[model samples]
Target: MAYRHPDRETIKRILEETDTIAVVGLSDKPDRTSHMVSAAMQAKGYRIVPVNPNADTILGEKCYKSLKDIPFPVDLVNVFRRSEYCADVAREAAEIGAKTLWLQLGIVSEEAAEIAEAAGMNVIMDRCIKVEDSILLPEGKTNR
Candidate 1:
């Protein structure tokens, strides 16, 4: 009954192929980790959509209160909420048909991961997206 993520190769494939990401709990504050990570992804040419109930816009992109409010399909849902809230995000990710559900560093929920995996969505837990992206790049290709 435990959830197991796919191998590194599969995760790499998912990350490399994803072009758009919906950043749940993204914040407008410049000092916030969510903002920093979103900025990094945006610089890498990935379309970043900020999903936060209080944010109107972050990094020049329009913000949405929830995943369901996003008009277009997103390849990944990068969650920044606490572990206790991840299951809800995972459910919403599945409901909105996101291809992947990623729990940001320090946030992990086995139940959420299982739910996402069961929905055929790729799952990455307790990992920083920026860090993973950097590690996935070859020696000479890394910018960070």
Candidate 2:
């Protein structure tokens, strides 16, 4: 069966309810898409945990080497890695008890989505979280 993303209401609900987002593959460089997207989310009041080994910090948050390294609970696990690596990240996110697994635009993995869904995580593949936030939660309707 094909994987269907959550409906608009569900997506809006997830965006509204989530607080802390662990961004896997986030970069410190301002020019990178991961950095820009994460920054946009942070500006909109979501706490972003940078999960990149190459840097010590991004957006003023301490960088963790992996999802396992995050000391606190994460509401969402947003990934910027390639499709081939998503399953591993999904497993880690499940292990960490994250509520959602979000694959950035151009990234998709059926195996990852299956694992996450089985673990009770809401999966969103091939979508930009920043764009969703802008489009779904316009004019501060669900800004928190």
How far does residue 139 in candidate 1 sit from its true spot (Å)? 8.5
Q: Give the Cα error of residue 57 in candidate 1, in Å.
A: 0.7
Which prediction has the highest lDDT against the true structure? 2
lDDT of candidate 2 at residue 120, scale 0 to 100: 95
lDDT of 2 by residue, 51-82 (tens): 99999989999999999999999999999999
lDDT at position 43, candidate 2: 89
Identify the runs in model 2 with alpha carbons over 4 angstroms from their true place: 140-144
Where does candidate 1 stray beyond 4 Å?
138-144
Candidate 1 lDDT over residue span 1-144, tens digit each: 766656778877777788889999998999999999999888877889999889788999999999999999999999999999999999999999999999988888998998998999989888898887777743312232
Extract clashing residue pairs from model 2.
none
Model 2: per-residue Cα lDDT at residue 115: 97
Looking at candidate 1, the ten consecutive residues that score lowest on lDDT are 135-144
RMSD of every prediction: 3.0, 1.3
